[model samples]
Target: MSAKTATARPDTSKPPKKGSLHHVVQVHYLFTLPILIMYLVFFIVPMFMGIFYSFTDWSGLSSQFNFVGFDNYGKIFQDDDFINALLFNLKYTVALVIGTLVVSLILALLMNQKIPFRTGFRSIFFFPAVLSGITVGLIWNELFLKVVPVFGQTLGIDILSKSMLGNATTAFWAVLIVNLWQGCATPTVLLIAGLQSVPKDLYEAATIDGANAWQRFKAITVPFLLPIINIVIITTTKAGLTIFDYIKALTDGGPNKATRAVGLLIYNDAMQGGKFSYAVAESMILFILVAIVSFFTIKGTSNKEAGDA
Candidate 1:
């Protein structure tokens, strides 16, 4: 019986080989090779080339040019036009971020509740998000410049008698309104996701404990939604700061350059103004500002979250 049992028992003496872990790591690296190659070819190469050409006076059409070093950067700082554009972009981005956040939050809250035609409403809200910025800008431009004027004349509303795009002050707000209408959909979707992720049991418990709606939202909902809110803030802030297409299509950086964003300025410098190298330098500065702002904003928010946790 003992001999039969010994024969039936499996051997347990073998151990894993020393190189097994190394082999596993090598296989994982092989799996990532394609993405690594793509990043190198598309991202790294372009970024290096951009930085290199920024130092030289390389117009878009010319291959040969002398190195201008910091000359372009110096010019950018001294130019009143660049300063005005930068200031304008700062204000525009701030307003856009605030407007988008408020509008998206309100829509998200409304859509999250038990309501009629919820799915249909969500689809309607999200439909605008799939359209291109340039298309939305152009469509709104026509409405503001032509359709509104006609309707205004018919209705006898003198304030809308002319296109807002023709006025420098109102032109910025017009572009902003169009941008918010198109942009808020993404953040609204995100906020809805955040709202849905909140545990119903927690709300029920809060209700049983005599907590009001506002108190429940403050204590239960906000804490759970922090991560998504962080994502929304970072992404929306970045998008707001780099807005270009809408401005280009709507007013073409007019009237009197009041609505010219930094991105449009860069494009004009490279494509229209024929100062490619200078544009490249301006682009580098913009890149740095974005990087710095994104990094700090994300880090600061993350730290606050960690503390709250």
Candidate 2:
């Protein structure tokens, strides 16, 4: 064949088929469509409806309501129950964050060590996480009411001689203990995973450089675990602020409403008291509060993470 006759054909032939990006994206949307619809119907719609009603005088039983402007917002600040519940939630949330952080981190450290039956120990520690909150609350309620008192009496310990739930002063701590016991389980697991992820060579080098346990932890372990700790903080804060199930099953917001959380208060106002609009307003305030706290927490943690990096 003459070279001139073999002029190369332009590679206008179709390129090898890979895959359609559009098809993948469409498949993902298809998979998520049902969940998106459910979220819209269950959460987003109700949330907007609640916001709308918060500005109105809807009794929730009647179809008719009149817009009251900022009246509900004004009333929220002046309401003693709302104020008390807010304070209690603040206190509870702080304790939960601190307690969960300390307890879980400690347990994670311990569990990370080489020991006999480490897996079994981890399983034992993690058992609480799998239990239903309501079930655990109910079980703990009985213990507080029944078993704890016997131990208290036998030991002559005045604090536990009666159900901690029965005393306003002790009720907060009682709730905290149960929550910490249950709440720490997941965080501990997370921290253990985080601990395992820390490079052994880094620890060895730190030790070689004469860095003690605390120094190595501060310089290495904490930096690595910051993200997980941030998660723990956010979750525990939300749980503390929106506490209802535990309070409901354990204390019922009793002992003169000492443990009446905003969640419980909102429920009472909306369901039993029939202040539906009022409750909606309270809930909106709560939403704002949670948003504010979460915003600050995330911001602070991001700054720390960035600084560490």
Candidate 3:
């Protein structure tokens, strides 16, 4: 019989300390607390308060307010201007989204190619994005008022002197055109960045696979750029919904409120008309509409991403 010695086994069965997890959680909370607090203060709290005010008869300036309980919301639905403004805003949002995406995509593709003066072209494309909406509106107003007439005179057309914003139909189209022109630049820049980030090797591989130009673009470029495209769509949609400056400067909800957006209507109700609670209700409704539309849009995009993956 030999003496058997048992080797000391390594301690592999010890449980992790609860204190370690607690410390990690504490560290994460510490890092995230400031952002959470800021969001609550700036966004969450204000949003809830707005919702509350939407149900009240608060005149915005007065400290006293009465709870009206959905009457304001009911009035918003009944108001013809609110209905028209909502419709106009919807039309504008749809047109702007489609126009901006189409134009930006085309510009991005062109700029991605081995073209001369690419830097200059890019600067020209993106320059409008840096300008304030009010500035863009003012500049375009002058162009429509002055430059168009001069051009029209050179071409011998008298109709060019007519104010675009003076007619209901014309004012709507004018706002849409101005929005598309000024807004396309940012998305163009974003799409260009997305395009550049796509691997060149993927295109080469597609070419090797006998893929045509359109096929390569459809399969490779678009798929790779879908994430950025979603971002651009969300951003542009929100911007379109919240647009106030250009509309204020250009039409001021004129032509019998033909070009008035929900934002403008809300402003008119609150400041111009002194229907503060009603404006809050209108704002809340607009906010909900925006949130619902955006949610659906994002969900659809996310589903596409999942399917692609």
| Residue-wise C-alpha lDDT for candidate 1, range 1-309, written one tens digit per residue | 878744542443654453354555678799999999999999999888889888888887776898889888898999988898889888988898889888998999999999999999999999999999999999999999889788879999875678989989889888988999899898899889889988799999999999999999899988877776777778877887788899989999999989888898888887875687888888998899899989988897787677443
CA RMSD (A), model 2: 6.7
Best-to-worst ranking by TM-score: 2, 1, 3
Q: 77-98 in candidate 3: lDDT tens per residue?
A: 9999889888888788888888
Q: Score each candidate by Cα lDDT.
A: 0.86, 0.91, 0.84
Return the TM-score for candidate 3, rounded to 2 decimals: 0.82
lDDT of 2: 0.91
- The TM-score of candidate 2 is 0.88
Least well predicted 10-residue stretch by lDDT in candidate 3: 1-10
- Structure candidate 2, residue pairs in collision: none
For candidate 3, give the lDDT of residue 139: 84
> Which of 1 and 2 is ahead in lDDT?
2
* Candidate 2 residue-wise lDDT at 19: 35
